[model samples]
Target chain A: MAGYSSPQEFVEHVLEKELSKIEESESDEEILNKLKGLGYID
Target chain B: MSSAAGLLLLALMSAAGLYFDGGSGQHLAYIGPGAGFAFLGSFLTLLWAFAVSAATMLTWPVRMAWKAAKRRRSLKKARVKKLIFVGLDGYDPRTAERLMAEGRLPNLSRLAKEGSYRRLRTTFPSLSPVAWSTFATGVSPARHNIFDFLNRNLKSYLPELSSSRVNKPRRVFKIGRYHIPLSKPSVDLRRKSIPFWKILGQHEVDCTILRIPITFPPEKFNGRLLSAMCTPDLRGTQGSFSFFSTRNESVTYETGSRYPLQRSGNVVKGVLEGPDHPLVPDAGKLGVPFTIYLNGARNSATLEIGGEKYPLRVGEYTPWVPVTFKAGVAVKARGICRFLLNQTEPDVNLYVTPINIDPENPALPISHPSYYSAYLAKLLGAFATVGMAEDTWALNEGAIDEEAFLRQAWMIHEEREKMFFNALDRLREGVAACVFDASDRIQHMFYRYLEGRADGPLADTIEKMYQRMDELVGRVFRYVDEETVLFVLSDHGFGSFRRGINLNTWLLDHGYLALKDGAETAGPYFKGVDWSRTKAYTLGLAGLYLNIAGREAEGIVQPGAEAEAVKAELIEKLSGLKDPATGETAIQRVYATNRLYRGPYLEDAPDLIVGYNDGYRTSWAAAQGIVEREVFTDNPKPWSGDHSVDPVLVPGVLFSNRKIAAEDPGIEDLAPTALELFGLPTPGHMEGKSLFQAAAPA
Candidate 1:
């Protein structure tokens, strides 16, 4: 049986796979950590 | 399957088979009954041709993916040591080119010769905030939701100025990982937008940012940054000691004091006291009094007043000395007193400090703390102790003359420059974008030097300013190595506007609009206009739009009516109407924002637009009537130049010591290119393509 019920869900799943293809996908926590290391405090 | 369905299935099956089989397995094949086998073979041949074509079409994405991956891998192999962004706000290319030909800006000229330069296309309304935001976001105004310098606050329906602090809420927030505790609400780090440096920081690249406009209370990040808030009260010298005593305490503390305090040399050598000076006479000299010791001579007579004994040094430049006093001592005696130095005369005032009730838990001193952060904290704490407005520490200068204004601006610029260089030197993987507002500020203030006709007008001063900017470009290029890419950017270009245009009156005159309350003295577009009957409305930033019901509260234009027709009519009417004096058409081209905004962001845009004729801008004030009879005339007052008109051709300059493809690159491409240079992933949200990947110049 197919895991996804709809085309939109299927498209999203495929897109996520495409995104993960990159070695270092961006994360919010990582971005925030990087900014902090730079000395900009919010 | 039906014949059609069967044919489609056959086509899909063969296409998938050929695509999966690579190249060698693309030959025709037939396995069917006797006579039809020959026919099947013919169909197979056609099917094979179709499959091969499909395979070729499908291979492009794979190739693109491969190339992108290869480029990403190659970029990872090398690293960018430094990245510097130089912003020349409102730098006109025509003036720059003329100066370059004259060989005035040798530094900038050298950079142009060594790197790639192209005329950049500025955004609509062509205002500073709009263009600069576009440069920062690498997206169009519609996408970024910053269409005009002033967007109408929808709920209020009031035309907001770009400079108004009220528009701060709609402003995009840039949040980094660093958290700075502020009295005001901490900045929302969750805003959904990414800046170039933030992206670089994501990949562990550190950046130092100096004086970029619109960033105040700078967000937390991995790099050092001095927030560029170009307010009047910048902390130059926070706290300084002032000696109070009897004598001519002529003190020239510093050249640029926010406020001038009086002092004389006699005060230092005279009676000096601290609040803690002992009450008992002869218990201790309450405070030491000495003659002003400068240039090797005692300035004047001294008197013993408070604790601490110090001998006077006369007529010699002496190092700074502190005079201490015991607690609960009052020496009330008339003596010549000086506080501020350098004045022929000085003012005297009582200096006092409150005693702590509890020695162990003494109230936090409001006086200057030894540390800068501690001083700021104490100052903030004092505000709570005695309810004071946030602006209590604000610096105020009374009525600065033109010369004084220029001096102040220059001083600010110098400090900003230090902050810029400091940040640029430390950046590793990220692009360090720094904007020098001095160029724009100076241009706005002294454009009269170029455009002014009366009293010592400098000829071609605008061109000279451009030359200065070119030199700045040259200075920035020195930081980049062969691998580092550079971009010289501007928010918008500048032009001279003679007169302002008013569109409101034209609508009223044409009977397409109506007043709000049928009152005679109702202001135009001010609460009285019946929007239902109004076919089109023109605001300061947005030209005209049909009042469609669901779309707009008072939309008058019926749904599905030819919007182009109304736009065409408006354009024709606006174009035909010429200024009586100059006879120039004020309306340039009524561009549909959709046609121009092709990148990611496009929601917030004006419906029907009107670009003014070059050298003409809208008025400084809105009450100046919507329709004016005159076409061209000298500008009214205060501001001599305006930006609503078509700005001069402005180009972003890109430089590399290495030979680069002489191809045009979009500003958005900069972020991705930086990522590629550092071997980091360019987020999918980024729309810019790398220039390095573009084919080399012929």
Candidate 2:
């Protein structure tokens, strides 16, 4: 159990960890505004 | 010509529409002025958007389930939860050691003490594209098919971009005077082998790769990647800056174009050329006119482009200005550029950096998933999309001063750092990697300053850049946990390019290469060379190709034994060649492709790869096949540092958070090592070994 025996187990472990985090998706307009603020886009 | 007259005409047209044939006339009743066309276009756009959104919404659950399943299956044999690769392109091990010994780079020294650091062997040519291709694919340059940035087309003997090929759309519809492309133009990534991320993605391991060289037209896999190095500007070249001046000098710059601007009453106008119009067959390169209005009192200027005005102070760079080229109705190509007001008084000189493909509206594919670049643009605003974004050529040609060049480099570095940190924050269990080229670019432009030979104001630039990179490393260390493994490396080290050896002239002088009658020298691509009598030719950074009978168009040397004998003779004679000025050996060794490479594409490689000693490299003219008068000349350009020397002399540096068992790790080793770290077996096709353990397939 110290290391994964197959790729499937590793995926499950990663999915479990990913599921624990909060997910947020920003809209295109919002991303553009942020970029403009950062002086990367005008 | 008047609004009232237009309205009257529209009214007459509306009345005439009612007289059209029977059933068709009923449909035509809704056509008034331009409303019908606008309504139809908006309706179609809305309909398509609705359909796509509905489909995505309905399939979201199923797609999520499938991805989760795939991820679980791929990560089943995983060993590490997270892997981070921090690439400092062209970071020199010798300089790092010197600084570390002098107690200048504390963070790197601490990292070395806590974990491990060693010299990482580079590829044969030690070029960025070749070395990074090997790093990504875990193979030699022959296997990856990226020998150099420029590869000669044997048929025409013209040099072309090696990593990617962009072809115009094959099908077009001609209507009256307009030629509209009926299909999307295709961009092909020419690097042959699969990148390590694709292999990892197949195993269901998610990856976020940023700005890796030779990844232009990024390949599709289970990852997000931003392409780097070899990505062309909007004008379809590596990097070409535009210089506008009022000085009546017909000077030709090596890497940039100088245009004479006509000034009338404190106003100067110049045209900024973008990519070719995709919809027009013979429209040539589309150009947008810009005007600079000089203000002598304040020593400032106002730049007007595309109806927008920006204030420009002398010796100051304007922010990224978006430029649009109109191709046809509803067709516009966008790119971004920065302008520096070099001077404003007696001779107005303005420098415009090459217009990079706008990440928000890229004219060509610059990332995978197609939307990945757009997403990053949205996230970080607009960042550099052109490969080799630092504008070293501008600095080399004296179009921009040292301060301007350094400012541009660090600004790009800051943008890369933002994206890198964002990926790190998001990747909890997958791979996140980014390569910072500031170290490479700064070293390239400032090594002469560091060597105490050049009289420049920025002598400590290289040291400052290294310290900044160390700070970035320290920041990375703070973000990783026990489950995370970090790897910091460079593609190759750097050395001073003091002298340039024009191998073509040398070959011409030695009677190995031939020219036409009454022609003592030739221009680029051996224009005047008589190929029938020529036995050898040199093109690219370190390539020497023989005029083999079967392979070349006008080859004189026979293929089998005769070619081998010629190669042997050249190699023996060229190796250990000395510089007459200094009496120091210039070339260390000359390697035959057959002996150095063992891949199927070995035949496409250069017949001989030259390995120059430190402080020596191929001259600028020689790289383009130009035969100069002298065989050797002092390198006078600001690009005073280089790595296209003997591979042994420019070994890259590698540092890791974990102990590496391999005594001597090469750039190729990192790809296989990434797979091993994730508990996946190294594929049989890969020529590299894992640095941690023997993960060869049973």
- Please report the candidate that would top DockQ against the real structure: 1
Q: Estimate each model's TM-score.
A: 0.57, 0.86
lDDT of 1: 0.43
lDDT of 1 by residue, B1-698 (tens): 34455335335534554311112322211100000001122467778989999998989899768655754554465456555677766665655666678988676666677765555666665755556555555555554445553434333234432221210112222223211111121222111135556555544565655545433334555444433321111001111123342344344322121222234443333444322111122233234343433332323222233333333322221111223222221211111111222212233222111111111111111111113222322332211111010111111111223343344344444544554555555544456766766566555544555566323534454565576666666666657776566767666555555566556555766765666566432342345666666776665543455555555545556555566567667777775456767777766666666676653334235665567776565543232223333323465432344455543323434444444452665455655666666666655555555556764557
For candidate 1, give the lDDT of residue B390. Answer: 11
Assess the local accuracy of residue B70 in candidate 2 as a C-alpha lDDT between 0 and 100.
82
Model 1 per-residue lDDT at B504: 59
List the global CA lDDT of all models: 0.43, 0.79
Which parts of model 2 are misplaced by more than 4 Å? A1-42, B1-56, B175-177, B260-266, B279-282, B694-698
DockQ, computed on Cα atoms, for candidate 2: 0.02
Error of 1 at B609 (Å): 3.5
Q: Write the per-residue lDDT of candidate 2 for residues B1-698, one digit (tens) a residue.
A: 45455345434533444211122312111110000111122456669989999999999999889988987877777878999999999999999999999998887898788878989999988999899999999988877788987776666566656787664445554544444343455676778777889989887788999999999888999889999987777776666788999998988875577887789988898888765554344556678899989876557989999999999998888888998776433345668999999988788999998888887766667888878877888898788877888888787778898999999998889989999999998987889999999998888778898889876567888998999999999899877788888899999999989999999999999888988985888987688998878999988788899988867768889999999999999999999999989999999999998898787557678999999999999987888789889999998878889898988999999998888887789998999989988888887678889888634445
Q: Where is model 2 chain B poorest over a 10-residue stretch in terms of lDDT?
A: B29-38
